[model samples]
Target: MSAETASARLADIQSRIAQATKIAGRRADDVTLIAVSKTHDAAAIQPLIDAGQRVFGENRVQEAAAKWPALKTATHDIRLHLVGQLQSNKAADAVALFDAIHSVDRPSLVAALAKAMAESGKRPDCFIQVNIGNEPQKGGVAVAELPALLAEAQAAGLPIAGLMAVPPFEVDSAPYFALLAKLAREAGLDGLSIGMSDDFEVAVTIGATHVRVGTALFGARA
Candidate 1:
């Protein structure tokens, strides 16, 4: 998309978020927009950045490492977030690069992150991803196992910021968003990193503090 197009898209998304927040009786500042730039090259993403989208999400540590350093050097205000499943081995690299991690799911990852954070003296905010729908292929801690995972993560001194989830597609996402919000509240976490391109407005209405918008902001992946 052209820079103007991307700017318009960003404005539209912001407007929708404003409307959704109003409907929910919440201030627009309560929600953050994470532009998911995974699979999009720096060239493709620059327009969005030019459009003033500072917070971006990437799915892979390697891809982000390949792209963001130079981009960040050129644009100093950029904040990167890892919004995909992370391997324990990549924990240090991820901690070094990202400003937030929205996929802290299991005990092993929690331990790895803690060690990495201590070694690097950098503790990026962490969001526990929960498999709210019990999807077999999804990358989240099972809801049944959430409390245990949270305890382990907290014990490891991870900055437990909130929770993230990708609901089962082809299903009405409202309930899933609501469920995630409910789960976040029950866990005493005020932050909810739920929502995406298709359902983010609904998610904000239901109480998502962060929305991971990819396709809507960048257009479909090639």
Candidate 2:
């Protein structure tokens, strides 16, 4: 995308966020926009950053690793977030790269992060993935299973900042997103990763601290 095109798209997105926040009776600044730049290249991302986007989310660890170095050097200050299912084997590399992780769905991943964080001397903020839709095909702990998982993570010295979820693809998502926010409050968590290109306004309405927006900002991935 040309810089002008990318700038216009980003401006539209920010305007939507402002409108949504106003309707929701929340400050627009309350919502942290995470540009979901998973499939896009640094060429595409740099312009977005130059236009004043500081946070970006990536779905794969290796892909993020490959893109971050160049983007980091080019952009003055940027935060890389891992917003996808993170494997245990990638824990060390993840700790080295992301500023936060929004897919801590298993105890093993927690343990792996704890070990990796201690070993690498880094503590990347993290969120527990709650499978609000309870889809077996999705990657997250069931809602009913969260308390136990929270306990285990706390005991393991994992630094959990909040909860993350991808609502069912083909259903109304507001209820599910609200449910996750309620669960996060009950668990005393701080972050909510509950929005994407399709439903970010609803997410903001329902109090999502972080919204992962891709196509809405940079157009659909190629």
Candidate 3:
């Protein structure tokens, strides 16, 4: 995408976020817009960086490792987030690359991440992904199991930042977003990694600290 296009898209999303935060009686800077740049190459992503988008999310550790080292070197202060299901085996790589991890779901992955962080001395802020809709195919801890998992993560020395969730697709997501925010409050955490391109405004009004927006910022994937 052209630089102008990227700048315009980023501005539009920022404007929407500002509007939502205003309606919610919150500061716009309190909402962090994570430009989900998964699947886009450097050519596509650089424009966004040039447009002043410093934070981005990628799905895979390998893909991020492939691209971000050079990108981070070229630019400065770019934060990368892992917003996809993380396998236990890739825990070290994920810990090394991402500034924040938004998919800490299972005990195994939690253990793996703790070990990786301890050995590497790098603790990326972790958001426990909760399967709010109870969908069988998703990668979050079931709602019923969230408390236990949170305890385990805390005990394992994982930096429990907050909660993350993706509501069932094609549905009214406000309720789910509210539930996630409530869960975060009950857990005594602050960050809410809810919302995407479609419902980020709702997510913001409902108290999302981080919105992982991809399609709206980068345009639809090929």
Candidate 3: list runs displaced more than 4 Å: none
Off by more than 4 A, model 2:
none
Name the best candidate (by TM-score): 3
lDDT of 3 by residue, 1-222 (tens): 999999999999999999999999999999999999999999999999999999999999999999999999998799999999999999999999999999999999999999999999998999999999999999999998999999999999999889999999999999999999999999999999999999999999999999999999999999
Flag regions of model 1 displaced more than 4 Å: none
For every model shown, what is its TM-score relative to the native structure?
A: 0.98, 0.97, 0.99
Tens-digit per-residue lDDT, 120-189, candidate 1: 9998999999998898999999998999999999988999999999999889999988888888889999
Deviation in Å, model 2, residue 96 alpha carbon: 0.3
Order of models, best TM-score first: 3, 1, 2
Best candidate, lDDT = 3
**lDDT tens readout by residue for model 2, 84-172:** 99999999999999899999988899899999998999998889999999899999999888999989988988889899999999789
lDDT of 1 at 153: 94
